[model samples]
Target: MKDWWIYKGDPAVPTDRRLARLAEHRPPWRVFEGKVDPDHKVPSLDDKQYAADRERGAGYLADDAEIDLVNTALLLRRPLLVTGVPGVGKSTLAYSIAEDLGLGPVLRWPITSRATLRDGLYRYDALRRLEDANLTRMQATSDEQLLDAPEAEEGDARPADAVTPPADGIGRYLRLGPLGTAFLPTDRPRVLLVDEIDKCDIDLPGDLLTVLDEGRFDIPELTRLADHRRTVTVGTEDPDVRARITAGRVQCRAFPVVVLTSNGEREFPPAFLRRCIRLTIERPGEDKLRRIIEQRIGAGAAAAAAAPDGLISRFLERRERGELGTDQLLNAVQLRLAGAWTAPDEIGQLAQATLQPLSGPDAT
Candidate 1:
C-alpha cells in the first residue's frame, strides 16, 4: 500500500501506472450494487468539465506531501479531511482526483451555516408529495363523479383508473443528494466532494460520523412502505439516473472517495477527526507559485517569463505581510502582462491595486 504512494508535487501520475498499482494492492470491496443507468454512462475526461478540472489542477500544484496524502486516502477508502486557507486548493483536490483517475463527475455538496447531514444525504419533498396526493385524489373523485353522471359524452366516459395517478409515484418526490448518491453500489467509486465543511453547523460533522462509518443510510419514509412495496425507484444525484431502494435502505457497494474540505474556520470533534485521513495544505512557496503562475498565464515570450518572475517576487513580499491571496497574485501577474504598461514603473503602479494587503474587518 505504501508503494502506491508518491510524494511528487505533481498530480499528473499516468493512469496506467495507477491502475497497475491498484490491481496489485486492491482494498476489500466495500462497494454496493447500485441500479445501473445505461443511458447516463460516465463519460471520459475529454469533456469541458474535465478540461476545467485539468486546468485548475495543473494550476493548483499539489506538492509531493499532498500527493502522498491523496494516495493514502484512496487506498484506505476513508474520507479525507483537508484543512487549508481559502484558495489553497482544498476543494480542488477532489476534482484533481476525478480527472487523474477518470472517476467521472465529482458529486459536490457545498456546505453552509444552515447545512445539515440530512441535507447532504437526501431530500424528501413532503409538501410536494402532499400536493401530488391531493391532486391524485381530486382526479379520482372527478372521474368517479363523471362516471355516475349518466354519460355526458362517449369519449368523456373513460376508465376511472385511466386518469388516476399511481400511489407509488410518491417516489418522484425523493431525490438523493451528492452524499447519498455516492453510496450507490458501482464497479468504481464516485468522488464525493464536501466543500467548505467548516461552514456547517457544529453538529453536522458529528451527524455524518455514523453514515460515513456504516457506508449506508435508511429513509424512514421508504422504510415504512418497504413491506408493502418490493422496490421503490427514487431519483439520484445524477439526472435521469434513479435507484431502487429495497427495505428503504441505501448501502454502498464501494465506499465513495469522499473529500471534505475545511478553511480552518472551526474545530471538529476528536471523534470526527479520528474517522478521517487528514491533510493540511500549506501556502504555495516560490517554486510552486512560479509553476502555478506559468500554468495559468502560460509560457511564451521572454517578456512573459520575466513578467511572472517579477510579480512572483513582489507577491511573496506581500504574502509575507499577510495581505494578498495567491489568486490575487495571479490576477496581478496576468494584468501586468496583458496591458500596454511597457514601462516597468507603470506595471508596478497598477500591480499595487491588486497586490495591496487586505485591510478592514474582513481581512481575516
Candidate 2:
C-alpha cells in the first residue's frame, strides 16, 4: 500500500491529482456530497493579485518542520491553528497554501471580540428586507392612486408605470460570510483564513470545533423555505460570486484548508485544541532574516556594500530586550540602503525609532 501526501509542499509537484489524494485520506466517519453546480463560479484572482499571492513564501521562509505540519493538516483534513507574534507570517501561510495548490481566492473571516460562529457563516439582513418591503408597499399605493385619478391635463402624457422589485426573494437578503462560502461543495477545497482567532470570545473556539469537524452547516432561514424553494442562490463574500444552497445546507465535497491565526494572546480549551493541527511560528533567526531581505530587496544589494549590516545587528539586539517584528528590520534596511540616513551620527537614533518593540513600555 502506498500512502502519499496530497500536497507535497513542493512547487514541482503536479497538482492534477491533488483533489483525488485529498479525497482518499478523508476519514471514513466523514461524509461528502458534491452536489454543487458544475457551472458554479468562484471569484477569480486577477493577474497582479495572483502574482503577489504566489510570492507569499518569499516574504518569509517556512522551514521543513512547518511544511511537514501543513502537510499533516491537509492529509488529516483538520483545521490548522497557527500561533505567533505579530508579523511572523501566520496569516500569510493561508495565502501561500491557497496559491501553491491553485485553491481559489482565500475566504478570510476576520475575528473580533464580538464575532460569533453565526457571523462567520452568514448574515441575514432582516432590517433591510423590512425596509424594502415598506418602500415597495408605498410605491404600489402611489401607483394605484395615480391610476385611479379621474381627471388628466388635456396635453399631458400619462406617466410610465412604476416597477416594484420583490422584497421577499429571501436569497437576496442572505449572503454567505467567508466561513460558510468555504463549505460550498466546490470541486476542490477552499482556503479559509479565520484571521486572529485569539481575539474571539471565549466560546467561539468551542463553537468552531463542531463545524470544522463536520464540514457542514445549515441556514435556518433558508431551511424554513425549503418546501417551496429547494435551492436558493445567494451572494458569497466574493463579489458577484454566488453559491447554490440545496435545502438550506452547505456541505463540503472536500474539507477546506482552514488556517486559524492567533497572536498567542490567550489559551484555548483542551477540547477545542484537540481537533486542530497546531503550529506555533517562532521568530525568524538572523540567517533567515538575511535571506528574506535578499529575496525582497535585490540579492546583490542586500549582500553587497550599502546593505546596512549594522542595522541587522541592531535589530537582533532589540530582540533581546523585547518583541520586534521582522518587517521593522526590513524597513530600516531599505531606508539605510536608499540613503535616507547617510550620516553616521544619526544611525543609532534612527534605528531605535524605526525598530520599536511591539510590546508596551511597561513590558520591560
List lDDT for all candidates, in order. Answer: 0.74, 0.80
Model 2: per-residue lDDT, tens digit, 292-335?
78877867645642345466677777788888888887888778
Candidate 1 vs. true structure, TM-score: 0.85
Candidate 1 lDDT over residue span 1-364, tens digit each:
2445632323466665665555455465533445544443544557774677666654556777888888777777679999987767788888877766767778889999999888888899999878867887888787778767874665775664554555657688899899998887665678899999988998999999888877889989889997888578888887677777778888876578899999887889999998899999988877777677766776652235345547677667666666466788777767756774546666566556676665432221
Give per-candidate clash totals. 12, 0
Give the C-alpha lDDT of model 2. 0.80
Off by over 4 Å in 1: 1-3, 6-40, 157-163, 166-168, 301-309, 340-342, 356-364
Candidate number of the best lDDT = 2
Error at 55, model 1, angstroms: 3.1
Q: What is the TM-score of each candidate against the true structure?
A: 0.85, 0.90
